[model samples]
Target: MPQETNIPNKSILTPFNVVAGIIILAGLVITVLRFTKGLGAVTNLDDNNPWGIWIGFDLLCGVALAAGGYVTSAACYIFGLKRYHSAVRPAILTAFLGYALVVLALHYDVGRPWRLPYPIFLSPGTTSLLYEVGLCVFLYLAVLFIEYSPAALEWLGLKKVRNLIVRMTLVLTIFGVVLSTLHQSSLGALFMIAPSKLHPLWYSNYLPVYFFISSIFAGLSMVIFEGTLAHRFLHHKMDATHLRESEGVALGFSKAASFVMMGYLSVKLIGISVDNNWHLLFTGWGLWFLLELIGFVALPAFLYSLAVRERNLRWARWAAALSVLGVVLNRLNISVVAFNWYLPSAQRYVPSWMEIGTSIFIVTLGVVIYRFITTRMPIFYEHPDFRHDI
Candidate 1:
């Protein structure tokens, strides 16, 4: 038998799990109350604001957060930055969870979420950006499941299948990267159609480009953030080599993020200046725009540079985390905040307790699945000599 033992001895009652469970339960209860009543019963949404926090945070923000899977996999498999090999599995897993959550959140908001599949098969719309995103995301999700299958294979003691999946990983990875690039940019394209409705400050012809570039940082940042969480909570599940490998991935990601941020900053400056939208800077939204830029973009880019130069992985991790937050804010601004700029702030979509609860429940479910897979699979740590010569 291969050299192996069961996972570390830790009770399932870790504080994190307990807290997550409560949040989920509370959210579900709220959801039950909403369906029995109506959207008006629990939600603050009205005709003025059709979308709410579920669309802003869970769908838009969550997709950006999930960008890590594509970025890391691209670096390793496409770019052949082999030092980042260790980060690939976790990034893919996170992407799966992040997108999965978006689906769940949208399910709650749609008229008939159960009929979602109908759009895919029965009433497909090829020209719709949302349709493209939907198709691309669905295909990408399948790619992720395929890429992540080795973990399940290992858990089931199917060594042959695990080896086969690893061998075919290059093809699957290439497919995943292409789909991710398309869908991510398509997400930005979704807002582009609402150019007249979006705030003049954020809307531009280069929206797709900004969205794509920002997603690079978002993915990198998510990898760092999620890695920190897992390492802290699953201390006993870690090993020295795994930590060392992950550090290299972090450093590489930080440098890449810095470069991407520099490009993004240039576009923001050029976009606003060329269009003479400087007047918007004097309004309330302008202050928020400035805050988001300085707080999330400029600050984190500088910190990433400092961290990389100083070889300070800790600060780099924090910077990556901040970059991820910036990405989240940027996406939400496009989708919801800037979508209906003329609407009163009070009239904006506000999530009901049910919406919040369901979002939490979906995320918790993802965490549980991630934990369950990591506990028994080869997703986290792989033996250095375990290379398949396929």
Candidate 2:
């Protein structure tokens, strides 16, 4: 008989869970306040700065970090890297949840949240880049759900459906890669219309390329980060096979991230050279840009090489953390900081308490949901009955 467990252990009201509960409650209250009182009431947004943390951090960073699903799946299934098969399901679940939370954040950012679905059925703006982003996000969310459904079906003892979904892994992985490529690049394309609005230090005609390439490393780093945490905290739930190869998997991910980071650094420098903005490195923002590139990108790449060469999983985990931070900082720099770099301090956007609280709430909610699913489903490891195949 297959074992089924929900809530995992008896001690549910731990300190972490208590804090998460408070944040979730506060977030729900803030969300209601946002919808009822209007965007102006709970936000610091204005004519000069319409979007805030929700869009910059939650949507942009959220989507980019969630790239683990496609990256791992493509490696395991499409490229026939069977060694990485154990990591695929967890990556997919993370991606699914990450995208779902992005949709929630988008709802708070858009002025008319109710009209979000209008793009799909009622008012199709076929020519807009936003339309493509919206359509791809909607469709890809469905694809992720479908990709992850087999795990849930297996948990529920639906063997027939679980096997059926497992067979579609290749097709689903290919489709996911295509959609992720388009939308990930399109995110950078979103800022192309604002050439003057973006700082020369960051803007480029090759923004789309930067986004796509960096996402590969970003996904790899996330896999390392998430996998490290899982192994430390969820050891009991993980299979022995997964536990044994986990270090090797982390090393492989770090090696790949190192290579991608090198390419990203080269391209970024080339972007600066092409714009003849090398002189900007002397200015404050220019120095910040250099810090991001060298400290975050170059330094981490070097550390990853060291970690892999020495077989230091600890150092690899550190590199992954830095890499994830670098990715988030890059997104925030582009969307929030550089977007209004030329504007005066008085005219620039700053998030209000309500806005900050709401962002916290949304993030907390995602964490809670992740916990719920991991505890209930066969995410950390395969169920015994479903062990022969994923």
Candidate 3:
């Protein structure tokens, strides 16, 4: 005799599903409006302020937050931090999704999305920093894909392919680190040409150095942040190793981030002193800058230090969140808030509702995709078949 069992299907009408559906639908509408009516139809971008939150939030914040991939991989593969091995897959997945979304958001910002490949393939702008960013982003996105492919291959039961890709892990990590360094700094260098337009307090010759250094801690903080979220919602998806090592990863990253943030603060001070911008700090812009540095940067650094000293995971999580916000604030200050500072208030750029909605839509898409892949793939846990190999 044999018995048959039937399982009930999960409902698709849950709250998250409903909200995500609405966002996706709205995003489709905005996409149509953007392509049909042009950038003016969906954004507040103008000749004076061609860059808006799309560039500030989508590109700058996206890339900076995605630093977790290189940071985590470098720690594990290059720096030989074996305890962090459990974190590599999740970090790579986040970075891959983040960069993929950055490229997608660019389509909404650029006048000709199709021409994005033109600079890389057809006509390389060797003299332009933008071209360097484009090429690195393109290549680095490919590297992230390859770096993240092992999880997918494992899920598909492709052992040979996954192991082959695993063999190249060290080489890919090094190449990715180099590309990330170049583009992250190049992003800040792009604004150096507009020294007069950017506020005196924010502009400097060391802008590139500031950007690169901050990205290191930004990536570290993001790893902790992502781990916290994953622990909360995706707990069941993680295996014993991930759960066991998660705290260690958080604590170690917190210590590293704390030291790096202190270094970043010191360099920022040196930049001001070198540029002789001390007098500007007493003004309104200076106060705002101080808020960014002190409230966001210094406070988080201190919190991280305390977290590491006390071994408090909760404090580490909070510090990571604040540090992530600091990176976002710094990028927006440079690209949006501080750019065109001398312009009249009326002429300044303010994002339209549609622009904000589009950014939300893109982020929601990433969240949805991440949830889908992590649920199905070997991102949060080691596959039983390959446990010994890993």
Compared with the true structure, all predictions reach lDDT values of 0.81, 0.88, 0.95
For candidate 3, the 10 contiguous residues with the lowest summed lDDT are 1-10
Clashing pairs in 2: none
Expressed as tens digits, the lDDT of each residue in 27-91 for candidate 3 is 99999999999999899999999999999999999999999999999999999999999999999
At residue 209, what lDDT does model 3 achieve? 94
State which candidate has the highest lDDT.
3
TM-score rank order: 3, 2, 1
How close is every model to the real structure, measured as TM-score?
A: 0.91, 0.96, 0.97
What residue pairs clash in candidate 1, if any at all? 27-357, 68-219
Residue 97 C-alpha lDDT in model 2: 92
Q: Model 2, range 136-155, lDDT digits (tens) per residue?
A: 98999999999999879978
Superior candidate under lDDT, 1 versus 2: 2
Q: Model 2 Cα displacement at 234 (Å)?
A: 1.2
Model 2 spans with C-alpha error above 4 angstroms? 1-10
